[model samples]
Target: MIIRTAMAQINTTVGDLEGNKKIILSSIDSARSAGAGILLFPELTITGYPPEDLLLHTGFLRDNIRVLKEVEAYTTGSDTMVVVGFVDFSLEIYNAAAIIQNGEIKGVYRKMNLPNYSVFDERRYFTPGSRPLIIMSGSLKIGVNICEDIWVPAGPTNDQAIAGANLILNLSASPFTSTKNLTRMSLLQTRAMEYSCCMLYCNHVGGQDELVFDGRSTAIMPDGHRIVARSFEEDFLVIDIDTDQSTRYNLLEGKRKGYCKKAEVEEINVIIPQRKHQEFLPEETYRVSSEEDDLIDSLVLGLRDYTKKNGFKKVVLGLSGGMDSSLVAALAVKALGKENVIGVMMPSRITSDESKKDAVELAKNLGIETFEIPIESVFDSINGLMRPVFSDRTHDVTEENFQARIRGIILMGLSNKFGWLVLATGNKSEMATGYATLYGDMAGGLAILKDLYKTQIYRIAKRINEQTGTEIIPRNVFLKAPTAELREGQKDQDSLPPYEILDGILRLYIEESFSLDEIVSKGFDRETVEYVLRLLQRSEYKRKQGAPGIKVSKRAFGKDWRMPITNKYRD
Candidate 1:
């Protein structure tokens, strides 16, 4: 028998219940028109994923339930079976998927495995479910599970298969990291083959706060044949799966012996209307995006959704003509239109002639406005006033930081007067080593490149130029050494190690979680590793106050890496 399944990979904003409901209803209509018998949505489609503390509010849960009812009402006169994720409250809340057929609730599958590590605290909000839910549609025994339920090898999927489930529907809100999509696909294919069942994986897409979900949803046949949806965007994927394929690999009867008591499957029977069998199109594999391309897309979408969702139309950033600021400006143009981005060249006395020219050239190439604001007078006044407090101390980092603060004030001033959001351009290398000033370069409403390393920044800059087919980011910008221009002849390498070395050390320490000895063992100088570690530990406060950024890496400074500000444990 052939069954048509619709994977509704959609983008959802957190706490927008009515808007989310409207999108769901519209997707339902679209899926029904496409003649899909089973319609599946992402995890927590009603309230949005990681609703966080919003789940604590009683009214939020009630409103979600009301919205689910409204969605159930949509299926009243139709034969489409809607399986959508929402909050189900009994004595406590559950991350659940409600199965609806012909205006009636068939079953609710509470997510059994609540993820608690690294940007997930689902256990804090939800109680663990003990039983597996299987819904019988005609001859098809379809098992329902949430995001984390399918991750475990011996979890609900195994139990459901033992209880005569031939197909599993997994609704997920899995966030996008560099290698996460590939890893997720591998796991899904393995589960489908091992359980001898076709698996439908529907994932959330779009940006919500720091998390960006790339909806590369999939349908894996029992024989490991698969079809994938589009990445980093919403897609309605309708495909036909052969139900007879599961009969070839039955679960051993003894496999159900120990699980008989705790793994009793709750079964619900619904009459699946037999519709005309359309020709099943050949399943197409999604084109895999390069890591650099994926990073660029994630940043662009994250910035776009953050600004538009927060009610900001335009964004402003200081353009030093350096690699960091130039990349941020280009991204802003990509996220918002060129007209919506403003590049302010806040040049100090030490600013290079080339820097000023490059800034103008980049703005022109990008078709954005540029403002040259010379801060010499502001610097002179602040320096004179601070000379007395310094007691004739030689010009040091203090004076250098004053220059950055002056530029910060200018950017913030423009932000206030014109209602533009300020975008900080500091990369992960600087943020890791406390290379940014607290109220100076770090002062912004959002940090666009906070999670990208300095080396990765240059790679993306080159990729942008390559894709645009023109020198949008000036050629000189790539040739010039990266500098803050806070002092005369200032270069980033003068204060910190070379970016190649520094970023390598940082990747091991921050992303890889390598200790000082392990990092030093990897051919890095011991002293350099120790110094980088020291700086990273000391910079916790600055990162804590820094603006939120898009997370494209496995671990970002935002919610994933939680280090104490006062911790003294050094390795």
Candidate 2:
């Protein structure tokens, strides 16, 4: 028997029930026209994944069920079997996949495993399901499960296969980390090989607040042949598989008799017309994206969705002619389009001529609007006003921060005037060590590069220039000594250590969770490591007040890493 399956990797917005339903109905029509008998969508297709606190509202749940019924009605009179993720409520709520065929509800499979680690908090909202669900299409038995259910060793996948299921369908809304794609692919391949059944995985693509879902959905055959969809974008993948090859493993199925509970399984039978002499097309395999490519696309999508979904048509940011702000400008142009981005250069007396020139040139290169707002007069006025209160306190970091605050005021004023969202340009290295001034450079609706380190910032800038095949970001910006330019001849290294050493130490301390002794053993200076650690510990209050940014690492400063602002414990 041959079965054609379509994996709909779509982008969904949280709490947009009507919009999400429209997308689902449209995808079903597309799948049916492609001659696919079975169609699969990502987790929570009706209401979008991680609806978060919205799931707690009774009105939201009712609207979600209402939209699911609308989708089911749309699937009426079609031969295609639609499998979608939505919230199913009885005495309690459950993360569920509804099976619909010919206008009737077949069976709903509740997700057995509710993930509660890191970014996931499903257990707080959902009750774990105990029984497995199997739906039969002709002689082929296909099992359905949700995202976290397949990750367990002896979870629903094993039990479903043991109970004579030849295929498994997984619906997921897995978030993107730097190395998560590789790990996820390896796990899926292992499961396919272990169960000796064909597997289809569909994932959601788009950005939700701080989380980004890269929709690299995949189809794995029983013989270990894998086909992947696109990354960081929506894709409709259709593939034909041989069910006879998968059923041949039934001879070895008896080994799982003791482990399986056949009585607890809910089975539903449906008619599937066989296609004889059907032409099988070659599978398309997607190449894994490089770190730079993945980061750029992830940030672009995150920024695009955040701006558009929040009802903003334009974005504004300070163009400091430094690598961080320059990169932010380039990303803004890419995300919101050149016409929608505004670059404001706020130059003070201490700012370099080269910096101002580079800022103008970079804005011109990006085709974005530029405005020059010199702050020398404002700086002098603020100094004069504070002289009497300061008495004899000499110039220091406070004066430097005053310049930043002035620039912040100008950007925020422009934002208020034109209704454009401000994008902060501080990178992880600055935010980690409290080098950023709160309510100054940190003032914005969104932090574009909050999770990227200084070293990574330079690397991405170089990559952007290379990919664009032009010096969109000025080359001198890379070669020049990194600076805040708040004072004369000021460089980042004046206060912080070298970026190479600083980024390495931070990766170990922040992302890897390494101890001071362990990090020192890695050939870093003990004093430098301790100093950086102290700075990181003291900066919690600042980060807590900063705007949310995209998370591209294993441990982002946002929701993933929650530290108290007033902690005295030392590591």
Candidate 3:
């Protein structure tokens, strides 16, 4: 009556079928060696999570099925029942999981709920599945469902449970967003207690472009005891659960809930051969990571994967001695090693001595190579070239932007000559309000802090220093006024409100989706709120052109925010 289950919390690249196949096969062998009765893999194990437009290709779909078949062959003669996710195209494409045992696919459970909110766009590609699946393995009746299915009420889990399922297995590719892991575990615990069954959840780990999946795959027993895998990394978790200990039969008195009739559920029977396996006590412990730890780890993983997956071994960033650039440098060093990170100081006449010293000190502390490419001569040449057309025009924001563009050209030039990936240091607040000069400071392959607000950037910067046990980010960088140094004595607060106030309004307007009046009502000045919203609306075009960055918030600018550039209506 005891069942051993294993979950492979693995990292997969989108569209890398051959590579994913190797990982999946190795995981299957490991799970079989562990003597697991059932093994679960993350959703979209073949094609990787959120394959996006690649799913539209007919050949890709066939190739995914081919990989699944290949994996199925590896499970031949093994007692472990493998449930791995893949794309299924019967009449139409469906997000599905194949149940394989003894080299044969017992059943395929198509994901019933296709999420279409925020970062998820599954409904656009996948047709909704109607049938709820249950696997009858000896005395254990386990319900199988995909990510969104378990999140929604009255979904496949409920139907399968009503039809006498005592254990629920979920294969997920849920992306990291601040404290989503805690919320996910709480949901699983609630479901386990409600159904008087154990909830086994497996999630994808590592970064895919902007999305970083924290693979804290977990199991919640009916008694609320929890067992978890590694956080923000690949981990193989194996655990045992006694079917006799489940309270489902006692709660239902050996009768079905009748909410879903026996005929309504599609059942597959698999006979797992009883074998002598080593018994180990389940580690009923979950690693509870703080928001700071999760944030830093998510950023590092996202940056590392993005760089390596894109075929870039080294990264270069313009070090302005500001908080944003310094943090990005530290992250790049951590992700790609200090030898691969090159910090360039493109100082102009307006750049402060303190800024120059701060940038050098930071590079030294991080043990990174530094280059001081002063842009004064380049700025003069650009001005001389422009003075003919602008002989009568007065010096204004145009001159300030010229300096920024000159520095941008320098960074891009270094990137081209040395083949270094340029990292943009602009944060969410600057990206939101039109505070960044287009084609200037925003010129990079990836924007490290694109989705983070200015205040959040400061907090993260402080936390990095604390975690490293040294001032790698430089102590003076934290106290100095945040400035682009585009002009003499140009502080960010001069153009915009204080970060504390600006971030407060932005959190309400952007993330919380509050109206101008609504934000103003929440202890903010009406004029300031209106101005900030207007700036945000004006900056839509710039954000659309910027590089994609890690999404660690409830709503990021890339996939989540979809504002129009030619809109006339004002909030």
**lDDT of all predictions, in order shown?**
0.88, 0.90, 0.88
Q: Which digits, one per residue and each the tens of the lDDT, describe model 3 over residues 1-571?
A: 6678889999999999999999999999998788888899999999999999998999999999999999988888987899999999977999999999989999999999999999999989999888999898667788999999998867887787777677889999999999888788889887776666778899999899889999989887777889888898899988877655465444655433445444488889998644344374466778787787788899999999999988899999998888999999988887889999999898888999999999999999999998888889989998999999999999999999998888788889988998999999999999999899899988999997998998888888889889999999988999999898888888999989999999999998878999888887899999998888889998899999998989999999999988888899898
Candidate 1, run of 10 with poorest lDDT? 252-261
Which run of 10 residues does model 3 get worst, by summed lDDT?
254-263
- Candidate 1: residue pairs that collide: none
- The 10-residue segment of model 2 with minimum total lDDT is 254-263
TM-score of each: 0.97, 0.97, 0.97
Candidate 2 lDDT, 1-571, residue by residue in tens: 7888899999988999989988999999998888888899999998887899898898999999999899888988888889999999978999999999888888899999999978889999999988988888667899999999899988889888887888899999999988789999999988887788889999999999999999999998766788898898899988887777676654455334455455368889876555664465455585777899899999999999999989999999999889999999999898889999999998888888899889989999999998988899999999999999999999999989999999999999999999999999999999999999999999999997999999999989999999999999999999999999888898999999999999999999888899999999999999999999999999999999999999999889988888999899887
Model 1 lDDT per residue over 292-313, tens place: 8999998998999899888899
- Note the clash tally of each candidate: 0, 0, 0
lDDT agreement of model 1 with the native: 0.88
The Cα error of candidate 3 at residue 113, in Å, is 0.3
Clashing pairs in 2: none
Residue 423 shift from truth in candidate 3, angstroms:
0.4
Which pairs of residues collide in candidate 3?
none
Candidate 3 lDDT score at position 189 = 83
TM-score of 1: 0.97
Q: What order do candidates take by lDDT, descending? A: 2, 1, 3
